[model samples]
Target chain A: MATMMNSTVFGTVVPHKNPTILRPLPCSLEELFCGKVKNYTHEKKIYDSSGKTFTVHKSTLQIYLKPGWKAGTKITFPKEGDVIPNIEPADLEIVIEEEPHPLFMRENNNLILRKNISLLQALVGFSFSVPYLDGSEFAVDVESLTFPLTPKVVQGKGYLSQRDGSAGNLVIFFNILWPKVLTEEQKSILKKGPLSECEYLGLL
Target chain B: MATMMNSTVFGTVVPHKNPTILRPLPCSLEELFCGKVKNYTHEKKIYDSSGKTFTVHKSTLQIYLKPGWKAGTKITFPKEGDVIPNIEPADLEIVIEEEPHPLFMRENNNLILRKNISLLQALVGFSFSVPYLDGSEFAVDVESLTFPLTPKVVQGKGYLSQRDGSAGNLVIFFNILWPKVLTEEQKSILKKGPLSECEYLGLL
Candidate 1:
């Protein structure tokens, strides 16, 4: 269960002024936080930085910090599933404006890390995200699918041949083998997984 | 760590004379199996069916089962990163294409278990891997970052209404904020922390 994953802040979060309680809202919990709000009958109350917490039955609230909300500020939110029993806390999780993976980052300063790795190996983490291609939203197990073995760089050859007096180039070639098709339901899951809270499927 | 996962297999996996182990390889061990190979370098040798065990050396082996390497023909490979003692069985892991996740496969049907679980949560019991994305990849601690007051899902309501009502959507979103970048050495550690066999800079 120990995994190191890279993520970014979506917005600025601050400390809560008053002790507060989180209640499960009506409708689907996943729907409430999928990075997009659709339809809901009730409003949820969020504590402000001024140190006051109150029950407000509104779908949305304008959040303010005593100091203020600043872009690029770091904050954290506690997971909804756990709440300390009879304890006062300002339990918080950090936030960031989630940007696309650095692989697709505007600038590829990543070359520093790619130093001696084979082009194939350097790009191993680059997932085609089969779901991304179908215009569907389901998560694809990139690990489960097959990749074509098109080895371009000869083994034992350094990526930079000219630097060490050998046939070297800064590239590794490999091809991704795409799956024929995925179910509509699977597609939807991929598209929405990163944007919303996942709901519990009775099957699980 | 506790994980929610399930799988069941009904039929038996028939072994193949030759099984190719794909490589050039990705950052993760799992990618090698799912990838294709041009020249075969290993033959399939099943050690256990229920345990999904097998071995491959240097040979042209096809992963497809049945006539070539089809479903229903269960094959076995080593658990990821598994190695033998001085025996030095081989430097690489083997892949048996016929083998399927026990829980995900029921008889002839591939079960669609719940999706959208965080990568960390999903990695609990099974031994699988993916390419390593070097960045801040932890979901548990956000001591150095701040979060936004309003969660990101505020814009998803309209989209959900249009989707078919059979299944709901799920999204896993996180925000991360960093005040500054670490030294190049620190960046390398973060990307390979969980899997690296070396001591961290602090430890040394």
Candidate 2:
């Protein structure tokens, strides 16, 4: 009888709004498992933290993205690990580490984006479009709004909550951009209209 | 500021002799995240321990897979998780669960297989071919062998070890098959040849 053990590996994949996700593996690695890969040589150049570089030779392997595969995804290759002399080889596992997105922020299946709008737009109404995590564009219409600090929400437009089958809402927060320098005419115009209420409150 | 939390999900990938690994996600899941998928509703049917079936439609999601995920793989769908009212969605992690292989067994980074041979072959000499994990054929030769219990080994033909970045060996064990019944003519033939040495032993 042979003792069974497992080996784990980590990997990362960034998901776009599209349904399909793609991951590439070294050709040498594929050859290591598949024995051969036609005519191609598997090789990769990598650098360490100290800027030391090395070359790795392996066949290329591609992992097709499936549903339920997201950041922190872990997969195991049974009996695909090391050899212990007379015993059996262990299992191999692959873990994933997703790179952070630039435009969107996540919070428990909810998507958030911070947008900047002119003071006039914040005071009146604003309409804009933002990209969803899935790569789709969503138009946000802010109606009957006077404050920019409050966030606008679109129901069923956020992330898909794995916990509940429903989609979360997409929230857009507006940051009112105030003029860095105001001309006398602009100040007078502001004071006569939007600023009139502040003046009346004696808090301007 | 949004509180950052990571949701870990486990998945499974069966390792073949090929380099590519594949995983599939449900179409409903994609629709749930994308906010629209035509007229089909997103509903999951699940069976409980008591053998009761139920339909779930709350948008709450849970991924269930036996065993555990390996290391070295990551998938991140930004803001594709829970909705915290006004906050962003949490990150979703899918851990992998590797299915076991049928023919070969593992131990660390080594691969093992067992084979059976006739008693005549065990006593004289035998040669055969076996499939490597990577789908390659390797010939094993046994010469000057009297015992049938010993194993044959191929160096550096096992699994790749992550600790040392080297491959292990492939092990083959032999099992001697015995005849259920012996005919008088066969017995006499055996007694005149290979059995001649036993006659020198007083115990025989």
lDDT of 1 by residue, B1-204 (tens): 111233334664332222223333111212122333423344434343333444543455344322122232233343222223212122333333433432222121212221223222221211222121121222332211112221222122111121332222222233211112233343343344331222222120
Residue-level lDDT tens digits of model 2 in A1-204: 223233344653322121122232332211221133223223333333333443454554334433223455445444443323322434444444444556666565566787776534543455777755544676878755335256887787655555656667777776655333343444344333322321111111
Model 1 whole-model lDDT (C-alpha atoms): 0.27
Instruction: Write one digit per residue (lDDT tens) for candidate 1, span A1-204.
Output: 111233335663432233333332222211211223223233334444432543454432222221111124343344321222222243333232323332211111111111122212222233333121113443322222122243332222221122343322212234322222334443344334321232222213
- The numbered model that scores best in lDDT is 2
* iRMSD in angstroms, per model: 17.1, 52.7
TM-score for each predicted model, relative to the true structure: 0.14, 0.34
Worst 10 residues of 1 chain A by lDDT: A105-114
Give the clash count for each candidate. Answer: 78, 95
Kept native contacts, fraction for each prediction: 0.00, 0.00
Error of 2 at A25 (Å): 10
Best TM-score goes to which candidate?
A: 2
TM-score, candidate number 2: 0.34
Q: How well does candidate 1 match the true structure in TM-score terms?
A: 0.14
Model 1 clash number: 78
Q: Candidate 1: which docking quality band? A: incorrect
